[model samples]
Target chain A: MPDLGLSVLLKGKNMARLLGGLWVALRISLIAVAISLPLGILLGVLMAGKNRVVKAILRVYLEFIRIMPQMVLLFLGFFGTTRAFGWNISAELAAIIVFTLWGTAEMSDLVRGAIISIPRHQYESSQALGLNKRQTYFYIILPQAARRLIPLSINLITRMIKTTSLVLMIGVVEVLKVAQQIIEANRMTSPNAAFGLYLTVFVLYFLACWPISLLARYLEKKWR
Target chain B: MAVKILAETLLSIRHIAKRFGDNTVLDDLSLDVHKGEVIVVVGPSGCGKSTLLRCINALEPIQAGEILLDGEPIKPDGKNITELRQKVGMVFQSYDLFPHLSVLDNIVLAPRKVQKRAKAEAEAEALTLLERVGLKDKAASYPRELSGGQKQRVAIVRALCMHPEMLLFDEVTAALDPEMVREVLDVILKLATQGRTMLIVTHEMQFARAIADRVIFLDGGNILENTPPEIFFTNPQTERARQFLNMFEFAAVKHHAPAED
Candidate 1:
């Protein structure tokens, strides 16, 4: 077979650095997800509410996040905010903040869609049966909405993981950043190392996201 | 069985007007339903029969008017609305059973959660109600597992488990298949015989004539005629009421005759 330059990943300390870089990406994303899940759910419910002002405010917020690019958001969080607010925010903290903001907006929309997808008759029937608002959501609405939410949210988690790659633009030194460093360091020894290093990065991403995709598929089928 | 409608009014609707945007559904409609009275409301489609029931249960907000249950006014966002709703149960055209819950859980949910009743007591009551509706064995079944008629009966049982003073049925049998309609209607007929107070909005004329203590004929967002079922069905005063009855009678005639084929 032709030489595909697959040997660079087997070199000293390079593989370990890549793994550490991946963990950095994962840590930021996992922390963001943990914060987003509950906060997003609350915001979702509020977004679905009848209050004109609250709905309008959340509408503007959701639209703003959707309209702005994630890269610009990261730049704003890391560099622009530091200049404007006169506070020193670390690159990792900035990455976490930016990802959490993006994740929350996406997650809340998912929850809002899930909540509104339920038939209006469900709410009327529950109310007629003397269930208070809180009781109705707990006993009837949430349990059903959760099924729709779980599959969609797993998909969000995967997206969040992949999107964490964007944080390297702000100098967070994540997987893609480490892969570039390795490729540069090995340029003289292995001129074809760029191909293998990039290929390894793709494999690492697939390995990280494939099982989650499988879980989402399994749940969607099982619940459906 | 002949129910004795007591002189004391259990529910009183006073000049209520309900509007959706520019369209008026119920305009200046007033009614008094006494204890143990079976008031069946018959109207052309979109004549506000279901809206009236929803307004009474506080599901729909009235643009104008007052509704009193046990001499206390009922408002959509009233402070004691939850407590008031506990005393007034409403079933819908669609069965609207909680799909995620088993029949037993659906029935006992409100009793346990709102009324703060003991779990054993709620389940026992639910089982008893289910048995009365001929659904004793279906207590563990989810809404999707049961037939439409079975689901509607469970919806009724769910409402009854709350021990509401009055029940509202908004075309509860409308969604069932022809054969399944009887089973659901039979349950309502049994409730009427047992002297349960009810306000029923239905198109089942024969059943309405059989069960209603009084019949209210509605049209154009108003009650055109409020009379006993005997008078209302046989000799409706207005030309509008006559035309409405003729349409049903005409259909009934087609129903009994041999198939054209």
Candidate 2:
């Protein structure tokens, strides 16, 4: 890493710490997406409730997330409500909580749209096949709907990664915030290192997001 | 008249009426199916022919009238509806084969999941059904890879693997290619040879005449005529039936000329 102009950042052991920060960001994102997908499915299905009040509540909740800025959500999670409510939540925990809520809602709506878009006859066929409601969803409808959902879910994971940047506002020391701190510390020694350093952060984001984008396309083709 | 048998009704639909918003379908329709009887419901498109079939299995909720299957009532959210539907397997005009499953899984799914059969036993039964449908070699192939006729045959076997006492065909050949239609008809003819009871909704009069013990003509959501095939084709009772027959004949003739030309 030091052979190129990267040597300045790669001196002694700073590279390892910077990489450790990147790994932490990656770890948070991976856990967030894993937790959010199934949560989203649960919420999306709850939104499909037959009762008017339940449906109305779900609609309000989903629209609330959709309309509000994600940074405001981070603020609400980290600073505004938790302290006021007297809860001792960590910044990392708040960041994860906020992103999970946001990712799950969006993914759930995608699931809802995909499941409902299936020809109504698919459910009728399952009924005719003698499958009970649980069996129908577990076996027929989910398997079919899943084919349409893989790409969308992958896209959601990538969105989760990009949105984690908003967590920097919540004081989560993820990649971008760490990069900003490192550039500030080295501002005197490496005069133009800020742009190059930020470029590394950009590259890290690309490295994380590009493969996911490719995987989404690959899944769409494989399933289609 | 040993085969004349006691007339046992397998299904009794008494004056069922269904509506989709302002569109009234299946208006005051009453019908009965004797055990082991094959009835074909034929009519022009938009006459609610498919909806009537769905009503029998309680796939669509009926606004009025009652349906009794095997002496048990079928009502909305009724406890016994799932078991009744299990006894009634339906094949769609588009084949509706689960594209994801192989021909084998398609057959084995209901038996293993609904009937709670052992996987090994289900596999054995699926193999036999695949052989019966002449799809033994295609068992491992997906529906997308199969021709239309083969897919429909696989669908029939899938329905039969559920061990339904009666099977419903909602124009299974309509989406099939012209060359493939007869291949599917041949499978239907073979099923008839084994005396399997089926209620078919088809536009193919020749298949209807050959297999249906009796044919019921539906038009404007009403039973215009119900009689033996010879009588129904030779002498339709209502003006609507006559008009339907003429149109069907015109369609057949129109379809036949292109092939010849």
Candidate 3:
């Protein structure tokens, strides 16, 4: 018989533990996204530089981050680089560092793409209006380009949240990792509870990403 | 309008040539525009009419020539770009109204930032311009909310708010609806009578003929005719000028003469 009373299965410590895991996941995601924003904007601006030498260097860096899988990057940061550098960092901090780097690179390229996609005439028109370079950017270019960037940026933030689950492989106790621990420990003592704990983790991710996705879509429609 | 102080030659260019990969947009172009002179540049597309206007403001760097505004070359060494931009205002073919900004903010930004006008003063000035352009009711509307003519009107006022020594219009009404075209042209004509020095890049022969103090016909990246509008439009010397004017007339009317401006 199928278990129709799955909601009833979660009670007391089991429920509390599931909630705690979700909070941990949320915290990691929030911190990771926050740390990446300014760095991403700076790098993105650099990638849009007109100078060929500077642009080439930025393209290489941006592409490397984009092409590599997040898992390999996590391993390189936590194990390979940490070993190479002779640093004994904790897995939680390492996971944060890796995710921050990955998220920042992705976010910056999005910003660069949005900004550069602005028509060439917009810059010329602003300049013709007698706005020197800096004034043109602050008054004309940036404000216009920013509208295109916001929805894309929010989408990136949600992706960052979803990708935080991969950090569980680094031994960090994010929501999914915590859920795994609960499942293993309580496996023999109520095997069905293991299934309930994983389902709760899945629901938590859905909750976090749902509003963000909705926000991105809403902004897209509204701005259009 | 007569030259009020003769404006001491507001802008002058000498032997300027521009090329992109051996494709010259302007060749040996030279002209001197006085303050308050309404000079209309008319030509076939790709004859470098817009490029010349852009060069006066340093929007496009010219190769192998020099441009002087008030007898000074605009160079990278000049530090007061905001000040210079405050002195020159340009309206574009696309209107280039900031889509995110309301019709009012589009006018107020350059003044508040570049000209250092107080927000209250800038808005007051902007409101007056909007009123002049008949867009006072559209102050709060975004660029996307306005019709093409209304957007271009806001653009004209946005340029005016900078208090430019001269205004440049790069085919300002070329992109508008037929009914909308006259409204924008009306604003420019009104500005002309009010003594604004302007360089207009246009193909509208009727508007050019009505208001242009000086009209220059550019062909093959060279000025084929430089004379008063009456001379250039009525008595075109070059065969090329006659051919080009015919095309413009054809676009506006079905059975137009080839020799008419």
For residues B126-168, what per-residue lDDT tens digits would candidate 1 score against the true structure? 9999999889999988888999999999999999999999999
Alpha-carbon RMSD of each model? 4.1, 3.9, 3.6
Cα error, candidate 1, residue B133 (Å): 2.3
Go through the candidates in order and give each one's DockQ. Answer: 0.68, 0.63, 0.62
Output the number of the DockQ-best candidate. 1
Best by TM-score: 1
Compared to the true structure, candidate 3 yields what TM-score? 0.90
TM-score of chain B of 2: 0.92
Weakest 10 consecutive residues, lDDT, candidate 2 chain B? B252-261
Can you write out model 1's per-residue Cα lDDT over A1-224, one digit (the tens) per residue? 75566788888988898998888988999999999999889989888778989888888888888899999999999899989998798999999998888888888898899999989999999998888899888888888888889878998898899998898889999999999999899889898888888888888888888998888888776755
For A1-224, candidate 3 gives per-residue lDDT tens digits of 75432453354475677677677767777888898988888888778777788778877877898898999988888898777999888877787787788878888898788789888877876766656778777767676677788878887888888888888787777787777776676666666765666677778889888888788778777765
**Candidate number with the higher lDDT (1 or 3):** 1
In model 3 chain B, the worst 10-residue window by lDDT is B252-261
- Candidate 2 iRMSD, 1 decimal: 1.6
> Candidate 3 regions off by >4 Å?
A1-12, A211-224, B1-7, B246-261
As for DockQ, the candidate ahead, 2 or 3, is 2
Q: lDDT: which candidate is best?
A: 1
